[model samples]
Target: MSLALEFVSTVRADRSGPVDTLADVDGLTSWARAHAAGPGFTASEEARQETVRLRQAVRALFARAVAPEPPSRADLPDLPPFKEALALVNATALAAPTAPQLSWDDKPVLVIAPAAETDEPTRLRARLATAAVEFLAGPEVALLRTCPAPRCVLYFVKEHPRQEWCSTACGNRARAARHYREHKK
Candidate 1:
């Protein structure tokens, strides 16, 4: 999965309701470190706000990419216009000066390197936005599906021809609900 998919999954569906894992600075900091966007990145309140906005933008784009299929209910409230979301994500990805640069160990490796002057938060945002842009442009976006299982608000790439729900747990839940409905009547 792309970091973008994982990032978008942060706004999750709970039994009670939608939950935002990045609702606070500490959460954002932990997420950043976990994603290796920056190992020691400490998110400021400003960075938290910016990151959330970027997430919204990415979610909006993902919603558009999976057109005609409803998007994650969790993201519905914050989604901006498709054009606006596209602009925001592209802008964020362009904020840092990054280029394909060569790095060599035993074998030569090509890497996209952002400028040394860019701060951690900015670089983190750029990396995430770039990944989202790439995901949206790539063929995998066509396989994106919003989980149809009741109370599920996640998206997943359809890995198999028979795949429907986001996970086996969701599939089981959906089947159980269907069985209950059928027998109750």
Candidate 2:
């Protein structure tokens, strides 16, 4: 699965974050169901709030793992949702080895070669693991970065080492702002 999809999947309450207890996998199934129906599945106000909470919680968790900030592990709660998500993320991170090279295809495809293919979740996790490695290992890999768009936290492997924007939309906006400033001078 694509990084964006993976991110969405991880955040949804149906897939893996729904279970109240870490031992039960029902929460993951709930998350998957919620995710399949789309973000709008949060029909009620309470559900909406819960969805938002989950999204923020999951995003923070991922951001911290990929881009470590500080020592706040003590403040965290022992929630099953967090534990399950962290396990998935960590496992993926581990699977994502630092390969010296990656191949390019005319068709956009991400091939994941892992031990298990029977489980959809496992396959998804493995794919993410491969992607993490690819993002970390590719040329200009240092430039591999997440979208700076506030709500858009998707990752992209930059073709240029010095790339600052994830797309022309962002780059153009930044340039326009600069030009506006220059004209004000």
Q: Which candidate should be chosen as best, given lDDT against the real structure?
A: 1
In candidate 1, stretches whose alpha carbon ends up further than 4 angstroms from where it belongs are: none
Residue pairs clashing, model 1: none
Residue range 1-185, candidate 2, lDDT tens digits:
34433433342122232322112344444553443333322233343333334433444454444454321221135323556655545565554233333447776555534443333443433444444445334443444355553233344445676776556766776677778889995
Candidate 1 lDDT trough over 10 residues, lowest sum: 32-41
Tell me the tens digit of each residue's lDDT in model 1 across 22-141: 999999999989984757789999999999999999999888878798888886876989889999999998888688898999999999787657889999998899899899889999
The estimated TM-scores of all candidates read 0.94, 0.38
Per-candidate local distance difference test: 0.89, 0.43
